[model samples]
Target chain A: MKINLALAQINTKLGDVEANLAKHLEYIEKAKAEKTDLLVFPELSLTGYVLQDLVASVAHKPVEDDPVFKHILAASRDLDLVVGFVDEDSRHRFYIASAYLSGGKLVHVHHKVYLPTYGLFDEGRFFAWGDAVRAFDTRFGRVGMLICEDFWHASPPYLLWLDGADIMLFSSASPGRGLNDKEKLESARWVERVTKAYASMFTSFVVHSNRVGYEDGLHFWGGATAFDPNGEELAHGPYNEEAITYTQLDLNQLRRTRARLPLLRDERTALVQKELDRILNRG
Target chain B: MADINLTLNTDLARDILSGFIKSEITRVGLSRAVIGLSGGLDSALSCALAVAALGRENVLAVRMPYKASSKDSLDHAQLLIDQLDIPNKTIEITDMVEPLFQLDPDISNMRKGNIMARERMIVLYDQSEVFKGLVVGTSNKTEILLGYSTLYGDSASAMNPIGDLYKTQVRQLSRAMNIPAPIIDKPPSADLWADQTDEKELGFTYEEADKLLYLLVDQRYSPQEAVEAGFNKKFVDTVTTRIRRNQFKRMQPPIAKVSNRTIGYDFLYLRDWGT
Candidate 1:
């Protein structure tokens, strides 16, 4: 199977979810015009990152019954979309989440498992942690979703591959920090290294979508990128610009690599399960 | 070809900074600005950025010189005013601070400098009410991190434009803004005491400090790692220690966290208070 995916690296204002939803509608129309099958955006693309108290006002559930989401749901019928928004539960507890919409329905919702709360980030104070990681099938292929900081750890992507995902997509709102020899921002280079290594190790296609623009003192560099199953870069977008990069992912390449490596197939699940049980019980 | 040459696109920088100044000032219900013009690169860059944002007619550049301040300082400041054609005033702070300094005749030059800084801020803020403008700050990221500024003194301002850029970066930006070449090339000084240069007292050049700071702070390299990256161990240790010790100046007065939400602790966030 071949699928054309669009990476929407956009600039989002803090705590303006209504305007942000409007932006989503416009991007959906553009993606549809480009004849793209799936479109992915950065983490917290609707509300923006570094929203300490503003998150409370902007947080909302992507419920189908709501007219706000109905506009997006109507637009997603022709073009599937993965968008980031602050997911407020019925009890009003919030989690940073991404919604996968296809066939005019919210197909799957992935809550961000990792909430960074260190220097330049205070997400732990504002959000409740998510508790699940698994892969499910799409019309294109079996897919997995990861949020910003979750992929920093090797376990999340490892679990995704173990759960039979051939395609992986990540939503991020990473800030640009430091500069390399050519005076380029450093974060995107490290992310590219991670993307290639993950794709090659798992023999799966990977897509990373990021946000851009200035929010207060923080600058987000929108260098969204994608890799094929063989770990080669398929498409790359520019930095610090609102860019839409479209690329095709070939599912046949994943089949070819998995057949050659057989790393996932020849695995001992029982031994790993026993270790995990012992580790959890003792902890 | 240095270890980290951070040269910004001046045109882009100017636009981003002017936009930031406009938004920040207008959000606070003000269109004008007041700056403590010290004839230094940091102040010059801040003044230039303010003019770009709020025009020359709206910016009030107050030159507060002390009894021991250099004549060159006044001349350099006037050069900028003549070039920008902005309204400026030279206020002598000798009478304001001399009364306190006289009480303790044995006070160190550093103490005297602190007195001068605080007194200048008082004059600027009072003028802020009169001029109907915010006090745009001139303290750069280097001085701020190293705590080379006096608290509640020159550090107090309604907003700061150059606080993120290092001292070296400030010079580059000043050149980008077409500031006078002599002002950019002059040895840095607070002009608190005669013949007092900033680097001579600090025991380090800003070029050395900027390079090490770029690695240790911005790049997140350990002090030992910075030494490995070709910086001196003494310089790395000194820079890192100052950054850690001087972190208090970066934040507001610490409130005792008694409740779940305390102002300046858990509440009164920047976005909540301003934009």
Candidate 2:
């Protein structure tokens, strides 16, 4: 099966949900025009990232009940969307969350795990950690979803791979940092290393969408990318600008890679299960 | 693996900062700036950036020298003024502050230094109105975190062009911009009292503090992690404590929250939308 995916790298304003929803709709239409099946936006695309205390003002339920969700549902009849927003539950607990909307409804919702409280990240101050990572059936294949810091811990991807994932999507609001003497974006350079390695390690396709623009002085460099099961980059987007990159993925490659490596065929689940039980018991 | 180096692309950094100055000021519907030129590297760099952004015509460099301030301070400031081709003024602050010092007759040097620092601010802000320009701040991230500066004194300004840069980074950029060697090389002094260099007063050199700070703040290492990374335990603890203790100086006076939308909390909006 062949799946056409579009990565929407956009600059989101802090605490401007309506304006952000408008940008999302515009990109959704553009992706539909390109005949893309799924469109993905960066982390917190519904409300700009690093919003400190502004998260309280913009937090809301998933697209189902959100006032902005109606417009998104109307636009999604032709395409699927993976967008990020600060989610609030019935009890008013806030979470850094993302949703996969298809055919005018939310197909799946994934709350972010590993809220980073260190260095440039303060998600712990504003969000509750998500508890599980699992893959669900999409029209294309079994797909897994993970937010920015979730990708940092190899366990999430490992669990999703064990659960049989053919495609994985990652949303990020990473700031542009560590420029080199040649004026290259150093953070993107490092991100490329991890994305490529993860694709090869899991033998699954990976799509990463990062945001762009500046808030106060912190800059977000959008270097959105996607990699095939063989760890080869299929497409790349522009840095420091709003861009949409389209790439076609062949699901057959996943079968070939898994057959060749036989990584999943090897028996390690029992050992992992035992170790996790032992570790948790100790805790 | 332990080393990290990020010397900014000097030309690009200069262009970016100058652009920021232009946009931020013009966004508020003003095009002119008033800077306190202290004949030191920080103020000199600030002056140079303002000149590049607003043009030499729109910048006013005022030198307010205290009684014990070195003659070289005035000369170095003049050198910058001549080089940048900006209008300059000299205001002696001794006459204005001596009366306050005499009232106590035997006040501590720390108290007297603070009086001078604040007195300088008063004159600078007055000139800001007469010149129809905003007072540009020169506080770098190092002094700001350390609380080495007197609050509402040298720290007062409408906006800051170099507040994010570390002292070490400031030195690099100043050198890249060709700041005078004397001002850049000489020991950093607030010139509150004679021989009162910043490093001496803080009991640590900027080169030393910058390395630890680069590890702590920029690299985001925990206090123990910093010590493990080869920094002195006491130094790391002292510097980090000062940063935490002085956090109040970093922000505006915090307001009580009783309403649904407070000014700084839920209502934090960009400058583009004016109240």
Candidate 3:
């Protein structure tokens, strides 16, 4: 099966959901016109990153009645959307979350499990941590969504893979920092390395969408990319600018890659779990 | 101490800084920038980058010269104005600061210099309103770390584009921006007094200071670690102390916390909040 995906690398207005929703609608129309099956946005595409006190003000519930999600759900009937927002639960706990919407209905929501609080980041002080990582079946295939920092940890993506996710959608509002020897931002280089490694190791399609533009002092380098099951880059957006990057992924490549090197079919879950239990109980 | 790498990808740095100026100024509901052109490398580089971000038409270069300010300073600033062809104004700050100096007859050079700097800021801010622009700052990292600027004087600005770049990096970027060769090659000076230069005032060259500071701050090396890395022990100690002492110049005034969410303590929000 072939699925067309578009990475909408957007610059969100800080704490203004109305403006961001309008931009999302415009991007959705552009994606639909291009016949894309799935459209992905960077983390907090609806609410800007670097939001400290504005977190509570911008938090939304991904329901049919939400002001932001209402327009998103209406636009999702023709295409699938993986959108990022601040999610407020029934208990008033806020989380950095991304929701998967298909056929004008909410499919799955993944709250970011890891909140970075060191060196210019303060997410841990603001939002509640997500406690679960699970894969859900989409119309095209079984897929998983991981926000930035969640995929930085190995266990979240590994859990999704073991739970039978063939496609991993990663999104981030990563600010550009640390110029490298190759004139590339170090954060971008490290993220691309890990995404490519994940795709090759798990033999699954890895798609990444990082935001662009500046917020306060932070500059988000927009270089969205996708890697096929063979660990080759299929598409790459421009650096330091906003653009939509589209790529078509063939599910047959997964079968071919796994047939040659069956990393996923090694059947070692029981041994891994036993070792993990032993390691945890050592104290 | 080991030599630290102070090299930057000038192309990437230029683009990043330029984009920062544009995004920040426009985000604050202003499309134009008002920069005080001191005819020095730092201000020249800042003006060029502002022109790169906001077109020359959108950037206003204001030259505020006191009575003791060098002729070369004004001439070099004029040269940059001609090169970029941006709108510019020359407001002599002698009259603005003379009254304050007259009130205190025995004022030291430091007080007079500070008064001049603050007077220049008043002119720049006044022009910022007239031009409908934000005040773009030109202070580089090396001096800021050493606390070489007057508090609320040269350090004050609506936004700074080159504050993160050290003095050495500023010269490199200025050269890249094609600022006048004389401006980049000239000995660095605050030009507060007739004979004042930054290196002479700071007791060291910016080159050595930049390398030492890169280790101490960027590399997170302690004073002992920095001395071991080859920086002089006295230099390390003095530089570290200056950074600590000038901490007030780098931050907003501390507010006493009484409420649950006091500003800057628990009432955390970015400057870009709600914009």
Candidate 4:
């Protein structure tokens, strides 16, 4: 199947949820016009990153009775929308999350697991770590969602691939500065390389979306990208520029790539699991 | 090894350092200054500038080493003293700091680190009292930006000559001074913990981080612009987050406003005290 994917790169303000939602709705309309089968957005695209303490107050809880998300559910009735936001659980701990919407209902939500704590990041200070990886059944295919820093590691994407996700989508709010354009592009290239190598290794497609804007002394570099099931670059957006780009990915090519490279067929998961156990134990 | 640039050359740095010392000394009306010499680049640079401006006899270099401090650091610090031939003394602080740790065994590594820093500062300040001198600081601009130094510990000083220079720039000045090659080439550390390195804790090299910081904080590059300029987005985000998160460390403690112009309240005045 040939699937149309859209990457929305837009500017966002810190703690401005309503304005950011309005922007997301506008972008959704644009993506709808392009007739995209899937639409992806950057991390924290709703309330922006570096909102500090405001995350507790502004984070949205996915309630069946909540009107804001109800409106999103209504608007996304016809299209597949993947957007980033903050989710508040019952424990009151906030999570960096990506919501998947399809056919006017909430399909699945994935919480960010890797909370960066060192220099220039206090994610550990503000948000709690998520425990599970979620995949959803979609009209295009079985899709998986990951937040920023999730796709940086190879394990999450590999797990999603194993869980029967034919397409993997990443939403990120990657900061930009000093030769960061090349760095971001190179990083994207690395992600593409890994996804393609892994996609060919696993027979899947990978799509990534990033944001653009300056918030609290940091700038988000928007360079949304997509790789085919064969791990080739199907499309890429400009770094630091707000844009929406689309590409068509054919599912048939995934089978061809998988057939050509049958690495997954002859894999050793037990040994890999043992190695993972060793790494985690060492940590 | 990266080629270090101060951005401000030796002559310019000398002028800036001298001017900062002269103005601060005049403002405080102090003829003598005391420094806690760690044998590290930051302290060495600060002590050198202080000696040049106030004369060797007026500047006191106090080396306060604990149990964990490397002998190389002491030897290098002695080399700086002997080379400059400044008035100096070595005070073993292990006896003083060990008791506090014994009293509270649950004291965190962070707390222990702070105690080590504060112990040294206590010695420096006590010496200041004996010598009638002001405590000169060794913190650099990068440390201040990241809030890496301990407040009232390494962060507390009357004035810092090298506070405006980044770590990369400090290395440049160190090289220009022909200060021993070992001191210039050695990795930066507080020596609070054995085999500890600053960059390892910070998650990026000073050269990479300082360049990112200069563009983000100084040049006002947006995160997107920074990424476009070839910096890693994750690294950029990390550096920018640190700068924002540590903003509190850059300012005086917050106080409830009662007066029209309290010290850190409405009374916020320009730091150009002497000028």
- Runs in model 4 lying further than 4 Å from the true structure: A177-201, A274-283, B1-275
Best-fitting candidate, scored by lDDT: 3
Of the candidates shown, which would achieve the greatest DockQ relative to the real structure?
Answer: 3
* TM-scores for the candidates: 0.79, 0.77, 0.98, 0.54
Tens digit of per-residue lDDT, candidate 4, span A1-283: 7888889998775676777888888988888888887788888888777766667766896555665577677667868888788999988879999898888888898999998887677788778999998677888778898887887787888889777788988888876422221323334556556656755556678878888755533446677888876767888887666899889888898778778877667678889899989998995
- List, for all models, the DockQ compared with the true complex: 0.21, 0.19, 0.70, 0.02
Residue A59 lDDT in model 2? 84
Q: Report the number of the highest-TM-score candidate.
A: 3
Chain B TM-scores, listed for every candidate in order, come to: 0.96, 0.95, 0.98, 0.92
Model 1's CAPRI class is: incorrect
In candidate 2 chain A, where is summed lDDT lowest over 10 consecutive residues?
Answer: A176-185
Residue range A1-106, candidate 1, lDDT tens digits:
7888999998876777777888888898899898999999999888878777877777766777775678777888898889898888888889999988888888
Q: In the order shown, what is each candidate's alpha-carbon RMSD?
A: 4.9, 5.1, 1.2, 17.4
Cα error, candidate 3, residue B48 (Å) = 0.7
Q: TM-score of the A chain in candidate 3?
A: 0.99
Ranking by TM-score: 3, 1, 2, 4
User: So what's the TM-score on candidate 3?
Assistant: 0.98
Query: What docking tier does model 4 reach?
Result: incorrect
